[model samples]
Target chain A: MKVKEIMTKDLTAAEPTMTVRELIELFYQSGLSSVPVVNEEGRIVGIISERDIIEGALPGYFEVLYGITDMNHLSQKLREIEHDRIEFYMTPEVIKIEEDEDDLTAADLMIRKNVKSLPVVNKDGILVGMLRRIDLLKDLL
Target chain B: MIITVTPNPAIDKIYWIEQLCLDAGELPVMRATRSYLTAGGKGINVSIFLARMGIENIAMGFIAGETGRAVERRVRDEGITTSFIWVEGETRTNVTLLERGHEQRPIQITEQGPTVPPDALKRLLIHYKRALNRARYVFLGGSLPPGVPTQFYQELTHIAHQHHVPVIVNAAGEALAHALLEKPWLVKPDTRQHTEIAGASLKTPREILAAGKEWTARGIEAVLVSHHITHDLLITCEGAWDLEARDVQFQNLLGAEDALIAGVLSATVQGASLLEAARFGMAAATASAESEELVVTDRTAIERVLPKIHIEQLL
Candidate 1:
């Protein structure tokens, strides 16, 4: 079996400029922990997980909870928060796999790096599919 | 309230063909093909099945690009309510080929998905926390995306604990192993996954049961083993129980595991006993095996198989 043999082709991805609130809503509706971050060309650029949002919002959240009480002031703060983009918090370092890689090779990379998934790209570095650990195990079975 | 997360979701393209052939310098062709793009993800599948069974849940994850938009649109089109994290990458597409007339086998092809940045992952965690504030059950399913650590599930499990929410994890390998320390409410690992996690080639049901018990003792509230060829075993805090399904005419096997999870969670949410929920899971799984499509088992089908499923206590 190869990586293409058991990877997920149809995907749901995320954009760099999406707002935090919108991202949260997307996470709720989609039931996924992390989403692939891509550019206009549909290239795999980065990834955002649930952790990033939670951690990023923590400081601002604390400010609202302990530092402010006035409704009008909180509303003004909320606006600033809403304008935040995903690019502000997204991790820049990304690890990906080519689409033609063998399944074993992909599995080996995941195991070696202790990562759960890897982005698949074509020759042009266009985002194509996702190779997940569960998919790999499913293939193993 | 229950919330499930699916980071990399797809519009599953299932193709039914008479035969599949590949020739040198000839494009691989399929015969008599049929295609459907359903909301695809372990978490989303659970949510949809649960919803069909009248279990209210919020489907949470990520959506990106055009494919992501289509998936969200289609899911909403199904009347299944969903909330997603919008990102930059286009959602993936998964293909499954069913050789109908020839040998009744399936060939599944998947793509390597888009990369998720660390910030996106962070935003996702924050979203989970927000959802956790309202949810009683949190189901973290599917695989982590690129740029996220294998311990992502483990982190979520910890956060769920902080919010006093029970977590159920359906994953494999390091992702699964690392999360066990958090003592999730449930962990459903297929037989092969169990073998890999245990680092041994298990042969007998007894060995599998023993492994389940061990995991349960280690803080996992329940360990559900989905056997490849045999009955599924449910190891709860009480004891080990084997729920066996009667042999029935089969159609497709895909999505059976997800259906089982949905059934179990649905029953549990309704305050059903572990035994009862295990029976529900078994019945749902059996029903999935009887359907050609990945639709949730109807109430009648589930009830019909309920009596046929035998549960044996292994205490």
Candidate 2:
């Protein structure tokens, strides 16, 4: 089977400008472990998994020691953090496969990369689908 | 509640090869390949198919080691509820090599699954008893693990009977033979498995039907025999029928049988007639055969082929 044969065509993608909070909500509503971070042209640029969002939202010990530490330095750091976009936190090195690639090629990449999913792209580098691990397993039976 | 019992489940690893050579190492590197993982077993396949068909069910089975963890992760990812007993051994992994060409034939290599100890088998049976208390249908499928008694399905069917729940047996070999004595509500054995169990070299539909009748007389409520050319033969308490399919472009044949069973169960739940259920099963199987992947037929595909499938009643 080819990547196009099993990859989910209807994909929920995240944008670079989308807030971490909004991304978390989308993940919850969609029940997807991760969402592809796409550009305005529908090109996959990055990916943000559930682990990334969870870790991003975690309360840091530095926040608790803000009053005890340098107040000016803390304020400046907080401002920089708030100004950072999802692009800054998202995994830039995205693993992707072409839609026409066969299943073995995609499986080998996934196994080698130890990834659960990969974005399926067209010739023009437009995101079309997401080839998930479960989709491949369906072919085995 | 519906409970699916998979005696032997595997982590299905599918590799899409450019061209599958007879030997794995000697294959020419002409094209690219890809792969994906899924929790696989007859019962697990049924559960996922049921979920896709909008049926809420819990999958129950024995899992072990890392492969078991992968199975759990994949199943949970699909949003299917599961309650499996973790055994002592590692779960098995089935490898499927799909060659992309004008004619695609999947080369499936299944591993010898984990062996269950006597105590582990005993624990599994006890868990089944608990699960049966609330389940209306008990689906048992897949092979028997090593060291476990061959009569495991028979015992489970008996338990289901005590609870007045219908049992569906999708198995072969000694496990199937022993389960037949318990008179399951449904027994879905493919053409090859049916011949193996009956010890017959029968290839014609008439011969297969005669064998189905023999099993029906032996106390099986229904024998759903799936064939290559024919649609399927449903030998039930009411009568027998030959389900014929329209010629279509065949793609991958993987998971066609499991999809058929799921389709039948869906119809049964909706109070459809046995013949109607058989028709649905045939349509679903055809849908799977026509798709390049292991998928259930959508409403459009089923409707398009429904009228073309000829069901001949034979009492």
Question: lDDT tens string, model 1, B165-212?
Answer: 999998877788788879899988644434666463334678778877
| Regions more than 4 Å wrong, model 1 | A1-141, B23-25, B101-105, B190-194, B198-204
DockQ of every candidate: 0.03, 0.02
Candidate with top lDDT is 1
lDDT of 2 by residue, A43-99 (tens): 788998866653454436335553445557545544545544667668988999999
- Where is model 2 more than 4 Å wrong at Cα? A1-141, B22-34, B101-104, B198-202, B297-301
Deviation in angstroms for A88 in model 2?
53
Interface RMSD, per-candidate values to 1 decimal: 13.0, 16.8
Global CA lDDT computed for model 1: 0.75
Query: Which lDDT value does model 2 have at B170?
Result: 89
**Alpha carbon lDDT of residue B44, candidate 1?**
86
Candidate 1 retains true contacts at a fraction of: 0.03
DockQ of 2: 0.02
